[model samples]
Target chain A: MTALPKPQTLSLTVNSKPVSMPVPQGVSMQEFLHEWLGLTGARMGCGQGICNACTVMVEEPGKLPREVRTCITGAHWFEGKTVRTVEGHARQNADGSLTLSPVQQAFVEGFAFQCGYCTPGFVTAATVLIERLRAAPVPREAVERVVSEALDPHICRCTGYVRYHTAVRDLVLATPGLVTA
Target chain B: MRTFLLTLAGLAIGGTALAGLVFSGALNRSVVSRTVETPLTAEQIKALAPQGAKVAAAADCYACHTARGGAPWAGGMPFETPFGVIHATNISPSREGIGGWSRAEFHRALRDGIAPGGRHLYPAMPYTSYRGMTEGDVDALFAYMTTRTPMPVGNAKNGLAFPFDQRWTLAAWNFLNLPASVAEPNPERSELWNRGRYVTEALGHCGECHTPRDLTQGLRTSKALTGAVIEGLEAPDITPAGLTHMGFSAASLATFMGSGLSAQGAATHQMFDVVHFSTRHMDRADLLAMAAYFFDRDALTDEAPAVLPEPAPVAADVAARAQATYAGLCAGCHGAMGEGIPHVSVAMRGNASLRTASPSGFVRAVLAGLPAQSFPDGERMEAMPSFAADLDDAAMADLTNWMRAEWGGQAPTVQTRDVAAVRATLTTRHAAGD
Candidate 1:
C-alpha cells in the first residue's frame, strides 16, 4: 500500500490579510493562489520559473520588498512571510472604487503590456526597484542601466520590452526622490 | 707523518670541490648532453606527429603555455606564486621562442631543469614531475612542439623577488628534490596497471596539484595522491581509500576524468582546466587505466556513506534562517529537499565536495559561482549565479554549516571568518587580474 502525503500547515499574510490553511506538501505557490485562495492575477506562463510571469512581492519586516517567482516555489516556503500579488497593487477606496498604484497606473497609461502575460512580473519588479531607489537613489545617468538590470530577467514576448522599460523609466524620473542629478 | 697530513688535506679539498659542483648542478651538462635527431621529411613528421601530439595532450602542455586570447603555445600566461609571478615562455618555433634550441637543449630544459646557456629554470615549470617522463614521450613531445606555427612573441620576464630572481638557486632545489630516474615498466605489475601508473605519474603529473608539498615546497611523495589545498581550493583525495569513501567506482572515476561531471559532482577551478584541456582529449583506454590504477581493482565495492550523520547542534534561529534562505533562493532550481534537478544542478546528498571535511570548496562555489559547461558527451549544466552581493558573511556561514550538516553528513565547522577568508581570496585574485 502507498502512503499518503501529509498536508502541511501554511500560515502567512497575503494582500494584507492573514491566511492559514492546510496545503499539500510540495504544492507550488501559484497553485495555492489560483485554486485555494482564488487570487489568480499572477499568471503561470512558464512553470520552470524562467518567464517570471508568476512573480509576486515578498515583504519581510524591516526589509525592502523583493520579487519571488510563485510557479516554482512551494507555498509552505512562504510561511510566516507577507506576500503581495498583482491583485493587491490597486488600492480599494471606501467608495468601492479602485485606485491603481503608480506602477500600475504608469503601465496602463504607457500601454507597457500587449498580451499582458508578463505585465504582473514587470509591475512587481518595477515596484521593488522603485522602493529600493527611494531608500537610496541612483545618479540620473545610471537610471537606464539600473532599469535594465531590474527587468532583464523577465521575458516578454508580446512587446519588444521597450514599452515596459520606458514606462518604468518614466515613472522613476517623474517621481520625487528616486534619482539624483 | 708530515707526508700523510699533506695527502689527507689534498683529498679533503678534492672531495669538497666535487660535492660543490654536484650540488650546483654544474655536472648536469654532461648528463643531458646526448643528442636526439628530429624528423626532417614531411612524411616522417606526419607519422611521428600524431603520437607526439598525444604525448603533449597527456602532459597538459597547452593549458599553461596558451594564454587567454593569446596565440596557442605563444605563451604569456601568468602563474601567481608565493615567490613571484612567472610567465609561461613562448614555446612556438620562432626565432624569439625555442626555434633556436637543439634537441639536447630541450631535453635538458625538461629533464634537468637547465635551459639553453645553462640557465636554471624555476620549479614553477613543473620540471620535477616531467623529469619522470619516458625518453620516447619526451622526444615525441619535442617533435610536436616544433610543428607549432612560429609566433614572433618574445618571452616575458619573471617578476620574482631578490633570492628567487637568481635562477642559479633552483639548481640546489633540483638537486635536493629531483627524481632519480625516468618512469619504467614494472615487470611485477600487470601491463595495464603499469600503463596506468605511467599516465598518472609521468605523463599526467596528477601529483603536481593533488599531492601535498613538504616544507621546502617539494612534492611529498610519501603522501602521494592523498590530496592537498591549492589556490584556495582543496583537490580532494583520489587515493584508493579516498575514492572509495567518496562513492566512486572504476567506471565513475573514468567518466569523471573523461568529462567534468560525474555522480559525485562537477569539477571546478583548476581541475576543470585539467579536464577541459588535458584529460578530455585523452583516449578512453588511458582514462580507464588511470581509474583502475587509482582504485587498485577493476571493480570497487561502491559504498557511499549510507548512514546519514546526525545534525550538528546549533541555535534554533540559525537553522531556521538557513532553511528559509535555502528555500527562497536555492530550492527554485535545486529541489526543496536538496535532491537537485537533473542536468540542472548537482544533488547535495552524495556530492563529493560537500562530503569533504573542509567547507572551502562549497563556500567558494557559492561566492564565485560556476560557468555553464557542456561536455563532449552531451551533458550540460546551467550556470549558477554568484550570491556574493546578496549574502553576508554570517548568513553564508549559517547556510554552509546547515547544508553540510543536513545533506553532506559533515560537521558544522564553518564560521563567519572562514567565509570572509574565502571572499578575500576572490578579492585578491580580482585585484591581481586573474
Candidate 2:
C-alpha cells in the first residue's frame, strides 16, 4: 500500500457554525460528510462530479456563491472555506418554530420531489440561483430561462422539473427585487 | 361423406389436444378468491382514502384511463394498434361506468382480465403488468376508483379488425403471453427490496416501454429495461448496467426522478410520464430504496459507458450561409453561440434535446411555437416562439444542421425531406384532432 500523508488540522464554517478538525489527505468530502459529520443530506449519485447530487454551497465573504461537489474532491482542499448545506436551510426560532428558507419552502409546497434524494442538491442549487439573481437582477420575462440555466447541472428523475421550476419561479416572484420586468 | 367427416373430426380433436397440452399451466392456474369481509360503507371508505389514492397514483390508471380535458377516470383516450384502434373503458362509478362493481368483480377484472358478466378485456389495458400487483394494492385501487363521482361520459366504441373483435381470443393471448397473477416475495430479500420490486415491476409498469418486446409483443425478459423504442422515440436503457455506463449513481437516478435534469439538459419524451406521475409522487424513502434495489440487481455486468464522440465541425459553406439565417431568425432567444440564454432560451450547446438522432422534436418546436404551459397552480410557464412562416423546409434543415453541428457537438445534418416528413405527420395528427 502507498504511504499515507500525515494528518493535518483544518478549520471551516459549516452551515454558519465554525469548526476545526484533523483531516487525512485525499479524504473525499462526501465520505467525511456521511461518516464524520453525519450529514447524510448530500447524497453521492454518480460518485463523479457529473450528477451534482453532492453539491454544497461554497461561500466566501464577498465572492459569488459556488456549488461544489463533495464526492470527488478532497476534504482538505477546503481548509477554510465557508460551506452551506441542506440542513442549514431551516433555523429554529427562540419559540422553537423552525423557519425554512424560501427555496425549501417553495419546494415543499410545489411537491417538487418524489424520492427526494436529490432534494438537497436542488435546494442548494436553487439557493445559489436566488443569490445569483439577487446579485444581478434579470428581466422578469427571463425568469424561466434564468432558473433553468442556473439549475441545469443538477439531475432529477421525477416531476420533470415542472414542480421545481414552479417552485423557483414562485420564489423569484414572491421574493420581490429579485427580478425586474 | 363418411371418410371426409372422419378426417374433419380427427383434425378438430388433434387441434384441441395441441392447445390443451400447450396451455395447460395457464388454463389451469388458480385465481385468488375475491372475498369481501363486509361491504365497505362510505365512512369506512373515507378511512381508506389515503391508501386508495396512493394505489391509484401508483398504477398510473389515469394516464391511459382518462381522456384529455375530460372528467377524471371517464375513459376517452384513443389508442392505435396494428390490429385497430381501441379507446380505454370507463371505470368510474356512474351507470355508464363501474359504479355497480363488487369487490370480487373488480379483482377478477384486474387479475384475470375478465370484466363483469364474464367479458374478457383487451390486452391493451396492460393487465399483464397489473397482474403482478399484490392483493392489498389491488383492493386499494378498487376502493379509490369506485369512490370517484359517477360521470355520464359515454364510452368510445372500439374498431378492431376481424378476429380481434372476438374477446375470447384475448383469453388465449393472456394464457400464452402473461405470467400467472400470483406473486411471491423473495424469502432472501429485505422488505425494501420487495417493495422496490413491486413498485418498479408492477405499479410503475416501466417495462411497457423500457423493456424490448419480442415479435409476439411480449416483454423480452432477457433484456428487461435495457431499452425499447416507443412511438419512434427512444426510451433509452435505464437498467443499472446502462445507467452505470452513463455515470448515473443511485442518487443521480433519484435526482433524475425528482427533477428531470441529469447533468445534461432535460428528460424529454416518455420519461416525462414517470417523472410527472409515478416517481414524482413517490415518497423520498421509496425513491431511495428503488435506487438501492436497482444498483444491487444482477441483471447486468458493469460495462464502460459509451463514449460520446466529439462532434465533427460543420462545412464552411453550410456554416457561412446558415449563420445569417440563425442570427436573423434564431439567435435572439437561443443566443449567438447557440448556448441559449438560460430560462430565456434553451441552450443549444451540449443539449441532448437538439442532438438526438431523431429530428422530430426540433422540427415541431420550430414549426409550431411551443405553447406556454399552465401549471395546476395557475402559473403561466415560459413559451418558445414559433418560426413557422419565417423558415421554410430548406431554411429549417440548414439552420438545424448548422446549430447542431456547431454547438450540439457534431450532430448529423438534417435533410429538407426529413423536415417535410415531420411537418406532414404533424399536420396529419392535428387534422385527425389528435
Candidate 3:
C-alpha cells in the first residue's frame, strides 16, 4: 500500500540539441546514448570504464570540456547537462554530407587508428585536449610530452600510439596558438 | 643492438668480457661460456619441475618468446607494437638468457616489473597481469623457463620510436598502469571460479587482448573483459554487453578452450596459438574453472540467445568463383553446400570465423591447416589442408566473401586485399614456425 516513487525525466543537451526523456531506471548513459538515442559511436569496450572506449565530451559554460566515459556513467547524471559524442564531432554540410572535425581529420590524415573501436574515444579525448591546449598553449619543446601526457588515458590495442601521437603533434604544430616552440 | 648484447654478455660474465669465446646459438655447444661449469642434468629438469612445466606450457611463454625458425624458448621473437617492433629477450638457462638471474630477480621482473639492474621492463612483456600472479605460480614459471636449453642468440634491438625508445617513458607508464593491488579470492565466488580468475587474468593475460586500453595503454578499469579489437581482429565481447554475445555456455566455453571448437566449427588465427600452446594442454578442471569465472564475472543472467542469422543466397559472380574453388579444392570434405562431412571437414556455414568483421581467421585456416589435435571431445579428426601456396589472393577472397554471404549470412563480402594481407601474415608466421 506504499506509494511508488515517480520516474524522473532525464534531460540533456547533446551536440547542441536538447533532449528530454523519461530514462529507464538503472540504465547507464552508455545504454541511453546507444539504445535510446541510437548513437552508437560511444562504444562499450569495457563496461567498467577502464578502456575509455566509450568516452564522451561534456561541456559547461566558461569551462573547458571534460572527457566523460559514457559506459559506466549514469544516464540520470547527464540530467540538464551538455555532452558531445563521436557522431557530433563532425559538421553536416547543406547537402547533408558530413565534414570531419579537425581532430577526426587529423586522425584520418595521419592514419592514427587501426580497427577504430578505440578511435571514437581517442577522437573525443583528443578533441578535449586540443580545446584545453587552445585556451592555454604550451612551449613547442614541451609539445611531445604534453600531447603524450594528454592522450595517455585512451588505449589503442593496435598499438597505434606512435601514429596517434604523431597526428596530435602535427595538429598542435599546425594549429595557431595551440602550441609554441 | 650489439652494445645491448655486449652489456648482457658483460653482465653474464660479472662485468668481465670473456676472451676467445664466440657467443652465438650456432656455436654455443662448441663455444661454452667460461662461467658455467656444467650443463643442467635431465634428471634435475624433469625430477623437480612438473608443476613448473605445466604452468609454463599453459602460460604459452614459448609461443611469444621463440624467434622466427628458432629453437623453442630461444627468445628472439619480434613483437610489432605501436612504439616500434620490440624483440623478446632470451629466457633460456644460459649466460646470455635469464640463466644467470636469481629467483628474486625473476620474481621482481614478473611481479614488480623490475628487471635486473633495477630497470623497469615494458608492458609488452605483460608484467602488469603477471603482477597478479601468486608467488608460488611465478616460482613455477621461472623454474620451467630456466630449464630451457640456453641458446646464445641475443635478442635483437627493438624499433621503438622516439620518447618510447626511452625506457623511462615505460617506467612512467608502469606507475600509472601497474595493478599494484592483488587479486584476492572473491569470498562470494567458488574456489574454482577464483582459480579461473587468477589463471585467466594473470597467467593467461587474457585481458591483454580482450580488454580495451586507455591513452597510456593502461586497461580502462570500468569496462573490464567486455571486448576490444585486437590488432584488427575483433576479440568478441566475452561480456554479455556485446551485441553478438558469446553464445557458448560454461561447459561449451570450456570445451572450446580445451579443444578449439565449440558449437562453432573451428578456432582460427591467433586463437589457434592460444589453444595450441596454452589452453589445449590445460586439465579439464582448469578449463571448467575458466569457463565458470567468465560466466560469473560477465554476469550473463537473462542474456538473449544468439539468434542464428539466415544469409541471403550468394551473388552470381561471387558464387561462380566460390563454387569453382570449393568444388576443386574444398568440396571433397567440406561438402557442396558448405555442410561439413563429419569427422573430416568443419562446416563453414555456422563457423564463428566467417561471421567476424575480418576474415583473417578463415584466411589463416586456409593458409595453415587446422590440425586434428585441436578437435573438441578429444576425438581425432581429419584436418583442413593448407592452400597457402596453391590459392591466389583473388581466389581466396572470392571464396571467403562467398562463404560470408552463403554461410555467415550477415557478414559483408571480403576484399582481395584482406585476403592478401592475412596471407602475408600467415607467410611470416609460417616462416616463424607458428
Q: Which is the better candidate, 2 or 3, if ranked by lDDT?
A: 3
Please give, for residues B1-434, the per-residue lDDT of candidate 2 as tens digits. 99999999998896677566544534534264635535667776667767878877767787777887888889988887767889998888898888888877777788777888867788777777877877777777777888788888999999998878977656666767778655678878777777777777777777888788877677887898887766655566678776654446677676666555543444454565556556666676666667666776423234453344355687787776676566544554465556555433455665655555566667766776554432222322245544564467887888788767765554556899988876664544232211
The 10 consecutive residues of candidate 1 chain B with the worst lDDT sum are B425-434
lDDT of each: 0.81, 0.71, 0.72
Runs of candidate 1 with Cα error greater than 4 angstroms are A1-5, A13-18, A38-72, A82-181, B1-33, B37-41, B67-78, B84-106, B113-122, B146-161, B165-168, B297-331, B336-338, B386-434
lDDT of each residue in A85-157, candidate 1, tens digit only: 9999899999999999999999999988888889889989999899989988999999998999899879998
By lDDT, the best candidate is 1
* Tens-digit lDDT string for candidate 2 (A1-181): 6677566676888888887888765467777778778888999886645567888888878767867777755676566889887888898899999998889889888889899988889998999888977888888889988888767777887645888888898899888779886
Tens digits of lDDT, candidate 1, B203-300 = 89899888998876899999999989887788888898887666666878888889888877887778888998899999999998888789875433
State how far residue B371 of model 2 sits from its true place (Å). Answer: 3.5
Candidate 2 wrongly placed segments (more than 4 Å) = A1-181, B1-44, B181-194, B241-252, B259-263, B266-274, B291-329, B337-345, B354-369, B374-381, B385-424, B428-434
lDDT of 3 by residue, B62-84 (tens): 77888658977777788777667
TM-score (C-alpha, index-matched) for candidate 3: 0.54
Per-prediction TM-score, please? Answer: 0.78, 0.58, 0.54
Which prediction has the highest TM-score against the true structure? 1
